[model samples]
Target chain A: MPIGDAPPLVRPIVGRANRPAITSHRGRARWERLAPYLLIAPAVLVIVLFRLWPLLLGVNFSFTGDGDRNGTPVGLDNYTDLWNDPVFRIALRNVGLLVLLLPVAVAIPGLLATFIFLRVPGNRLYRTVYFFPAVLSPVIIGSIFNLLLAYDGPLNELLQTAGLGSVDWLGDPKVAIFTVVGVHIWATFGMALVVFLAGFATLDTTLLDAARSDGASLPQVIWHVIVPGLSRTIQFVFVTTMIGMLTSMFGLLYVMTSGGPGGSTYLPEYYIWIQQGQMNRPALASAASTVLFLVMLVVGLAQIGLLRKAGRED
Target chain B: MRELRVTKWVAAVPMMAIALATIYPLIFTLNVALKTRHEYILDRFSLTESLRWDNLGAAWTSGGISRYFINSLIVVGFAVALLLLFGSMAGFALSHLRFRGSRTLFLACLAALFIPFQVIMVPLARTMADTGLMDTYPGLILAYVAQFLPFTIYLMASYYNGIPAEIVDAARIDGNGPFGVYRRIMVPLGAPALLSVGILDALFCWNDVLIALLMMPSAQHRTLMIGVTSLRGQYSSDIPTFSAGVLIAAVPVLAVYLFFQRQIAEAVTAGSMKG
Candidate 1:
């Protein structure tokens, strides 16, 4: 039978029918059939109990004040307060900076991968060295950078020696967000580069060779041939990196600046954490979380829409 | 040949520049870690004559990094184990079994992939506190497993798709149970994916700070990252000591990456593409 013509429901039963007479020995077959689910049960239970339960509880907490003010029901008052809160506005601006930097994160890795795939020598060594930071803990990266960028640290010392005067890196309100962004780009670019490299590997090499022989320049080949081919990888990296930028900014921000220099570095994730952990305003945290979730949902849907459009064009 | 060499050189310069830019800060940090407090103030980047083993020793002993290192290992070990076992099994079922709700479950798994952990951090922390699992190893492990399982399962399932169904059929004909077939056939066949997942998951769990920060708040329960953070305070100028603590925290992870550099690159490449 043709592969696509076969009924999907019949295939598994036929496969199961070939199993041994362990079933004829009474309880063995039933247990055998249920074994896979049994094996996977712990994972399912963990996700449900830990992930799903908390998600539901967060929604519930966003509506009520269960964990705030003696477990009282505050309805949507928390969200009302959040809507007018200036810190939330600052948090939104910080998130906007992150979103604006997304293209840089995607483009740098994409270009690097393209070059590596074009027979760049020592590419393996380059890849390894570049990806090294991705393996380090964000906390470690933040701490190291904090030390290096402090007013009395080496970066400013070098600047002073060069007669440019010292620039505040982590302490200045104007530059703290950029410092965090620079560190983030360094820590995350490697994996995105690797992913792009992988995507490039799947491209048809013959087409590249053909393009080259036809007098296509490297830039032309990349712009025409490689870019189109690696669109899926680009989309995947874009979405995941955007999600990381949205969520994982907390560690670096917390360790490096702690939203300091008058809260200029405060992202929504950091703002929510402070509200919940330090301020003991669980309801406001929930409200902020709800807003963050909505923002993520909107971005996610837009990404999906864009990907689908790209898929259709391809 | 000259043109080709020129092209290669041009391509390499940018890569090298980017690599150097990325690596310079780390090299600077290493230099700072070796300096004494006096040297730190005098010349943060310059090499110091007072490079003391005592600094790292003190960080290890006094900074409480040794305990945190052990704690990280235990948590990563258990979490990776659970991910491998349960993740691969779910992968097998989704690929081979034609049970009711299998498709729905698979889609659920996919949806879980997009949900960022920050969205659930507050509620998850509350749940942990309620369950009396705060500041404990098992609590952190359980949370890590939940966070990582979706991606792991998706990866293993895609890898399993590449296996020939005839092997599974042949095993079934030989009277192997579903568990037996999985154990004998699928496990060995899926070894590459499992190894890849194990390495990635282990690295993630080892390097994780946020969950460890929120879930394990006690000083005794803090991970290496937390230990390093605690070294920094308002009035203290313990740069060398803090840098030492940072170095101590990073050594294992950097060492592991260097040792398994090729496997990790390949695994990351494979996971991103397939996943």
Candidate 2:
């Protein structure tokens, strides 16, 4: 008879409580069956309790109230408040600006990797020197730039020497966001260069030779051959670079601008931080967090999906 | 070929300029750090005549960077250790073991990787407070682990994918259970991956301001990066000492870069390639 077909009166005989079943071969078999879960339990617990659970809780909490109305479900008041907030508006606008600037960010490293792949003089050394800044914390980078971009700092000194007027890099509202973004690019382009080099390692050099043999100009060879060859890597870089701009600039903003000078440099991340950390408005911050999460999900997943489809076609 | 040679040489000029631009800020900071406050104010552009080390001492002691430095070292140390232990176990199971819910658990991990810390910062803080862990070292360390474990596990799993299954099977036949096989085989085999991933995770924990800022609210609890920012406020007029404080925070990373540049680059590329 099958195990489940046994009568209720005899169920105890087949159940785990049976003495021989607990002590003999089947008990060892049970350990074997559950071993993987046992090994993965700590990781599962940590991730679920801290990362995933909090993410769900944060979304749910956004719908609730803050301060006097705490724990009471306010039903989207916080989100509407976020919508009406001007700093949040500027933050979203800056995100758009970052999206527009993404291509230039992706291209610089691509060209650099191409040069390095062609084995330029000191290419090896250049790779190390270029990559050095990418290892340091953004806080450190921001602090260093705070000095460099000081109104009377060395950058202005260099400009004055070159017969140009001093530009207040971090002080002027119109210039601060771009200046911070430029510093971020300077600080990060190296990692992308390394990724591109990794892509270059898999490139079909014979095709480059073929293009050059056909008297194809350098730009034409790059545009037609290398671009198509490295499409997947390019797509990866595009998505990662955009996400980096969204989430990782908090240190830079916090250290350099603190969302000041008319709040021109307020990215979504900085706004979320200000709302939660300084303003004590956790519900509103949760709303911003939800919005940011959705933004990232839409942008990130869309790219990965779009790129996978393109990759399949190619 | 001759024209190509000419163009490459022309390219070197801009490359050289870019390289200088890349390295100039650090060098400038070093120079400013070495100068006296008077010397820095008098002519910030000029190189220091003498190697002044007092500013470093001042930054370390008075700026409280030394205390913060120790705090960072302890927190990052614990966090990286815990992450490696948990991440490798999960990686080994997901890659090698046949079990129910394994795919879902792996997918759960991958999902966590994309939920950047800012998204859950508010609720995470509440969780910590609810558990009475906020501002504690373990609290901050646990936060770092949760924030980074998904990426660590993904890298480890990918690394383990390269290890053939025959060794694991042989180990099983030799009476090594799942934990035993992982301990003796996978952990040793995954050393290079672990090192690369460990260094990256350590850097993230050390470099992160948002998580550290949110999780550790008290001044004494500040990480080195937060300490660097606080010193920035207190020492704004005193450029040399401030530069010294910045250098104190940055020197460890610079040393790591000098030594493990290849590993760091490889780890980053590894993630990108898999993507």
lDDT of 1 by residue, A203-299 (tens): 9988887887787777788778887877778888888888888888788998898988788998888888898889887767877887898898888
Q: For candidate 1, write residues B99-186 as lDDT tens digits.
A: 5566777777877776667778888888888889878989998999999998889888888888878888888777777788789988
Ten residues in sequence with the least summed lDDT for candidate 1 chain A: A1-10
> Each prediction's DockQ?
0.55, 0.54
Clashes of each: 1, 0
**A312: Cα error in model 2, Å:** 8.3
- Candidate 1 TM-score, C-alpha based: 0.92
Residues A143-248 of candidate 2: C-alpha lDDT, one tens digit per residue? 9999998899888998999999999999999999999999999999998999999999999989999888888877887888998899889998988898899999
Candidate number 1, chain A TM-score: 0.88
* Model 2: CAPRI class: medium
Candidate 2 Cα RMSD after full superposition onto the native fold (Å): 4.8
**What local lDDT score does residue A153 receive in model 1, on the 0 to 100 scale?**
72
